[model samples]
Each structure stands twice: as structure tokens, then as C-alpha cells.
Target: MNRNKLILLTAVLLLLAGGGWFLHDSGFFQAVRSLEALRAYIAGFAPYSHLLFFLVQFLSVVFAPIPSNIVAAAGGVLFGTLPGFLITFTAVASASLVTFSLARVLGREFAGRIVSKKLSEKYQGVLRTKAPVFLTLAFLFPFFPDDILCILAGLTSLSFRSFALIVLLARPWGLLFASALGGSTLGLSPWVMVPIALVGLALFLLGMKYGNQVEETVLRRLKERRSGDTE
Candidate 1:
């Protein structure tokens, strides 16, 4: 590993250790018993709570297995809409860039360890087309395997700038929507929340069913456009 990556890895390790200490014997479950409880806990940290929230969001993406929506929702309850969305967006976007960079710098060998051979093979053809549009769409949707895609992106010909730009542009809406719901102080009746929940569920299922096809078709169109221009 290069000096920069080595330093980054060390920093990540230290952060993980610190987080472990925080969670150790702490009433993490009790905190989750209610939104108010969680909010109060975060507030107790005062001015630094935002920074702590930022770290959790960052770690969520870096760890990949951690579900970010829960933390993001908590941000909304704790900080309200605009601030919560901004915090989640910044953390997720920065984490995406970091994960992508790690994969790119570490090369295919490291990426292979992160992503399975079967999953890589499945998406291999789509990625080979080298379309940024598809990547942006992938990141935008909740059902897509975004973390896996980030690792896969590092193995592609895409530049870091383009990747970062796509991440920034595509990642916010879903998170924003979730955070907004959580932050809304207006006690929404089940009638309202249920329909909203249903819509989100429908969108998620649709993304799962059609996301690959949509990505492939977009890539094919882009490839055709490039070939025509060259011709």
C-alpha cells in the first residue's frame, strides 16, 4: 500500500477502535427504544454530536454491512430536515469516494475479496461498457447493491473525478426522503405514512427487478452513440 492509503487505513482502524469503546457496554439497544431517547443521547454530545453523527454515517458506507438508513433517520430526528440531509449526504458521498479509491488503488485482487466472483461476473458486462450514467442510476436507487458497485467501479476505466461527481449527484434523494420522513414533526397518520411506505416499497421492488436491464440498455445506447461519433 502507498503512504496515503496506509495512513487512511490506520485512521480508519483507530476510528473503529474508538467506536468500539463507545458502544462497549453502552445501552445501544435502550437508545433505540424511541426516537426521543436517541435524539437526547446525541444531543448530550452537544456541538460535537453532528461530528459524531457524521462519523457514523461515514462508517456505515465504509463497513458496507452497516445499514445507513437507520443512522440517517436518526439524523433527521436529531437535527431536522435540511441539516440531517446535508450531514447524511456529505458523509455518504465522502465515504463512497474513499471506498472507490481504496478499491482502485488496491487493484482487482482487493476488489475481488470485497465482491464475490459470481456477483462480479454478473455485472461485468454492464461495467465493461464504461457508462457513467448507469453508475449514477445505480447509486440513486435503494435496491441496487451500491457498495458492491463502488468496489466494482474501482476496477473500471472510470476516473476518480467522474466517480465522485456521480456519487455526489446521485446519492442524496433516497436518503433525503427517508430523513425527511423521520424529521417531520407533524404526526403523520397511518393513512399517510402507509401510502408513502407502500410507494417506497413499490419503487424498491421495481428497482430490484429492472435495475440491471436499465443499466445495460443505457450502456448499450451510450456505446452506440460513441461508435457513431467515431464513425
Candidate 2:
């Protein structure tokens, strides 16, 4: 890369490293495991709690494994549903853009290192295909690895604008739902929550069983359609 691009890449890597270390040292990851703990930890930031929460949310996406939904729920409990959703939506969308841009700048070889050889190989088709249909579905669904896909998308022929549109359209429902759950705006008592929980569990089980098949089906269909158009 040119000097400027190399410098930008270095800066991004350093920021991610520093941010990862800070989150670990601050016990942000541990705190996010529990709703009360996360709420209290963010609350400890006090006058600047929202800002801290935003940082935590942003880092969670870029760093991976921190569970953005749990953090969003904590924001809901701490800041209420609307504020929580807004904060999470902004942080996550920004982080997604950052990862996408990073991969685009760094190319497939570097992205393979970041996401791992196996994952890169597994999703390599994503790089070759320009269709956003599968991407949209993956982002919207609960079972897909949405964060990694954000990085993988950068290696595709998709324009930044197309990817941004997908992120904006497909990413909000889950965050909003999680925030509302934490905010208790649903006002779901045991009677309601019990059935909802059972249904959710059922869906989760079903997703686990067939999610990959569904993804493959979508991709296969898209490829067939593209081939037909070419023919």
C-alpha cells in the first residue's frame, strides 16, 4: 500500500488493540454478561455514562464475543428503550462501517488473518458474488455471524453505499427488540413472558437446526439467477 494507506491501517490496528485492552482492563466484557452488572458498570461512568456505553458498544462489535444484544439491553435498562436503541444503532452501524472499510483497504489476505483462514475460506463465495440478498437476510437473522460478514462484505464487489443500505435496513429490529425487552416497555408479566420465552426457545432450536441450509439455499438460488441472466 501507499504510505497514507499503510498509516491508516496501522492507526486502525492500534486503535483496535488499545480499545481491546481498555475494555478487558475495565472488566467491560465480564460486566456485559449480566444485565445488572452491565447497567451498574455503565452507570459508574455517570455524567458521561452514555458516551461510555457508546464506546463499549462500538468496541464490542469490532472486538467480537462481547454480545452486542446484551449491551443494548443494558442500555435499555439504564437509558430506556429509545435512547438505548439510538445509542446501540449508531455505535454498531459505525463499527460495521469501520470493519468493512478496513477489510476493503487491507484486502483478502489481511482479512483472512483477522477473520481466520477457516472462516474466510468458508465464506469465500461471499467475496465472489455481488448479490446483496443473502447479506440482507444474514444481517436480519439471529443465527448468522453478522459481524464477521461485515468484514467479509468488504472483499465483495458491493459498493459502500449498498452495504450501508443493507446495514441500515436489516440491523435495527433485533437491537430495538433487545432494548425494549430490557426497558420492560413490553410490560410482559410472567403469563406473557413464559409463552414468549418458550416460543423464542423453539425458534432458536429451529434456527440452529436449519439456518445453514437456509443460507445455502439462498446463495444457490442467487447464483442460479445470476447465471440465467448471463446466459
Q: Pick the candidate with the highest lDDT.
A: 2
The residue pairs in collision within model 2 are none
The true-versus-predicted C-alpha distance at residue 210 of model 2, in Å, is 3.9
What are the Cα lDDT values of the candidates?
0.74, 0.82
State the displacement of the C-alpha of residue 52, model 1, in Å, after optimal TM-score superposition: 1.8
Candidate 1 residue-wise lDDT, 106-169, digit = tens: 6765676567898788666666565487687777766567777887888888899998888878
Candidate 2 on 1-231: residue-level lDDT in tens? 688777877887788889989888988878877888999999998999999999998887776678888899889888888999999999999999989988888886457656877777766674466448777887788767788889988988889999999999999998998897777634668787677567656877998899988877766777787778679
Clashing pairs in 1: none
Worst 10 residues of 1 by lDDT: 23-32
Which candidate leads in TM-score?
2
CA shift of 87, model 2, Å: 0.6
TM-score of each: 0.71, 0.87
